[model samples]
Target: MVKSYHPETLEEALKILVETHCIPYAGGTDLMVRYRQGPGLVPNFDRPVMFIGHFPELTAISEKNGEFSIGACVPYRDIIRHPHTPEILRQACSLIGAPAIQNLGTMGGNICNASPAGDTLPPLSVLDATLTLRSVSGERKVSFLSFFTGPGKSILRDDELLTCIHFRLPHFTVEGYRKVGTRKANALSKIAFAGFMLKEKDMLSDVRIALGAVAPTIVRSRELENRLIGQPVAELAELMPDLLKSYGKLIQPITDQRSDANYRKTVSLRLIKNFVLKEES
Candidate 1:
């Protein structure tokens, strides 16, 4: 029989994880859906399951120094409503699923799901978010860029729980997020893009671009960013072709049910171009 553990404390959760090796459960939006079994369509808990969604330690949102720490179980609706949430992240959260899903879906679950089309990832990547993971042994922080190893995979240890996502509060002069999907709402992304640009006078000083659902993981090219930074925004039109070509070379989208590779490539490039040309107001 499948064993289930619901711990009220982070310490108890960590202990259970270390001992029983249970599948961590939060939200259950992805887990329950993926585990539906047989013609009867009952949810399967093939392995031991542990519920960590209600732990107070994993549900707090706080700020320290210049960084904001979002607890692992904070749902999309809470993130969308939070006053200090970054605009890019807020916009991304607002676009995730519909009202019911948003209310129950946690960012930690989204990150752990490791879907290539995850709406929150591109924005988190652009923000340079870090994840704090805690295990029975101790805790460690990992960059969001290094977190995912591939589609549906991450570096999370079986005994560790992701505690919080941390990032410096973004202060971009202009920032934007765009996701290409079949419909405006409740659709998975074919390609998604998030960009942050810091304008110093008439030149772009700091520029970060992240693309999602176009690779095994969210893709950010520092080499491309280096090429744009310190360049005058007025010259963006002249430089766009090469930039687009560079992005075309970097993205390796696959043909999937939601979209074809060619279409993803075309739309992703166009979105990048549009992002560069947008003016801060």
Candidate 2:
């Protein structure tokens, strides 16, 4: 049997999560569907679920001191529509699913689900997002890169809840986001890519690249980033293929229902290369 608890306050929610030792569900896009299909959403939970949707603490997106703080329960629609949200995240959100899915899915749910094919992870990785995890005990920040251990896995303790995602709005950065699926939207990505380029006086000074679905976890490669930085924009076309090859070396994709390993590997490279070149121009 499944037990449910809804707490109106953050402290109350945290206390319940700790007391029950249950999984947290906000948007329920992934959790409800998975639970309906099987017992796999969160397996073997001795405690019931603590619903944070009603918690007033986790439902806003606000900016302060050059950083945006996104409450865990803020739906994708709200994030995409918010005037202050970054353009890359907005574009990614628009491609997430249909209007209803967009309205129901929250950014925090996406992160905690920890799907490699998750649409928003690559964009968040580019932004160097920081996660704020809370429990009855206290709260702490975790870098996005170090947060996920694998598919459906994260560093978040069972007693803890992800409260907010905070990150700086890109400055002097040209952003790009792309996802390749069977359909334009609402299709799970076989391969996805996102990047941000910082140019100084027409020269590439810094670039961050993140890829999804091609790896067991969403990943950003420092070597590939280093290879492209300091190079002239004119050379990106020639350099793209090699960079893709390097990216493949970094991530070993698997054959899954969505796509074959070969296609995912090749398309991801092509997509990243194309996106980077487009930003360069």
Candidate 3:
């Protein structure tokens, strides 16, 4: 028999999650579709489910001293509307489904889903995000870059709940985000790319680039970005070929339902090249 739990508090929810073998339920935008059992039929819940979507502890959004903390269960709609949300993140959230899915989908769910094509992952990666995972034992923060192990896989334990995400927007003046998909609305990304740059006195100080749906994980190479730091922004054009080659070597996109490997890689590199070498505006 299957069981369901709706804990009144986040603590109770964490307790139940640890005490029972169950899946954490939130938004259910992905779980419902994944466990669907046919029209009008209850989705199959093989073990148990503990509902945490309504916990206020997992739905707040706030910023302090330029650092922002977003509750794990915050819906995309709220993130899209939050004033302090980075423009890249806000734009990615707005592109996520129609208003309906945005209203129901949470960024925590998106991270936990660990889909390579998730539109928000690229932005989160380049933003240098951190995830807070909690359980009855305690909570710990992990870098967004280290959270996922593979497609639909993450280090999140059954006993743990993702509580919030934290990140500081770097003092970057140039930022870009792009998502390629079959359709403009409610479409999953074929390839997602995000880049950020900070320049001072014609010299590059920071550069971050993340590519999604093109690898086992969202691809980001701080090593590569660091190599370009201190170089004059105008020189990026001279380094385009080598830079794209390095980025191309980093991404391992696969041919799947939405796109081919070659196309994903080519388009992603093109986006990066454009971001770095385009004329200043």
Candidate 4:
């Protein structure tokens, strides 16, 4: 039998996690690989595992007041189907992997895995999403922006569990996600970009930009976007050179098996330029 605790309720699950210090098991897509034992043998985990994948408390998508709450175990397919999911988020989830993986991968796993290349991150970053972390003691909220400490690391505590994600749609006339990878599908991204631009009467009202797989964590610069806000959209052509140069200083991509730093850097700037000056290129 699988050596995992299948709790009947969220409270029991949290209690098990705290007492046994067991790793929370959801889809086990990433964890299984990370802890793989062999071709046919069950994955080896250092400790007991708590299976929370089917708990209704962690699998439902619902809304209250003005905010939308997506459970931690909610799959990408569910997110893609939800009418309330932001277009940017939906696009990111749609391209995370093939349909099979999407059906099993949860945003909680993507987030808790904390890989810099995790596809959902850039979209969630720009969305200004918050995660609800629950412990037997109580619960508190954490900003997604500050959740990740570095590649493969996060601020989530040992006794806590990420229960849900929260976000509200913001006004943006332009929204898009652009990813550069070896293959169109089922490939890790060399660079991923999520952009949101709000322009009014040809004057830029707001700009939100996020880049992933180029830094320690998902890269978002409110400072850079603010500089472009309130500027004439037509004059973006004149401003882009300097803006791109500033971005060049902000992102740090390392050469990896998938791609090199120079190529990743070039493609990132081009994608950003296209988003900002949609009319020109």
- What does candidate 1's lDDT look like per residue over 188-217, in tens digits? 999989999999899999999999999999
Compare candidates 1 and 3 on lDDT and give the better one.
1
Q: Estimate each model's TM-score.
A: 0.97, 0.92, 0.97, 0.96
Write the number of the candidate with greater lDDT, choosing between 2 and 3: 3
Highest lDDT model number? 1
Alpha-carbon lDDT of model 1: 0.91
Arrange candidates by TM-score, highest first: which order?
3, 1, 4, 2
In terms of lDDT, model 2 sits at: 0.84
CA shift at 240, candidate 2, in angstroms?
4.0
Backbone clashes in model 4, listed as residue pairs: none
Model 2, runs deviating above 4 Å? 37-47, 279-281
Which lDDT values do the candidates have, in the order given?
Answer: 0.91, 0.84, 0.89, 0.89
Q: What digit string (tens of lDDT, one per residue) describes model 4 on residues 12-131?
A: 988988999999978888899899989999887889888889988889998766588899999999999998888888988888878988999999999999999999999989889999
Off by over 4 Å in 1: 38-40
Clashing residue pairs in candidate 3 are: none
Name every residue pair that clashes in candidate 2: none
Q: Candidate 3: lDDT over CA atoms? A: 0.89
RMSD of 2: 2.8
- lDDT, candidate 2, 1-281, per-residue tens: 67878777889888887777777888788877776645554444455877787666789889988889899889888998899999888988999988999988998999999999889999999999999999888999999989999988899898788999999988745777888898987799988888888877767888998999888899698877999889887777888778777777877789988899988877777767766776543
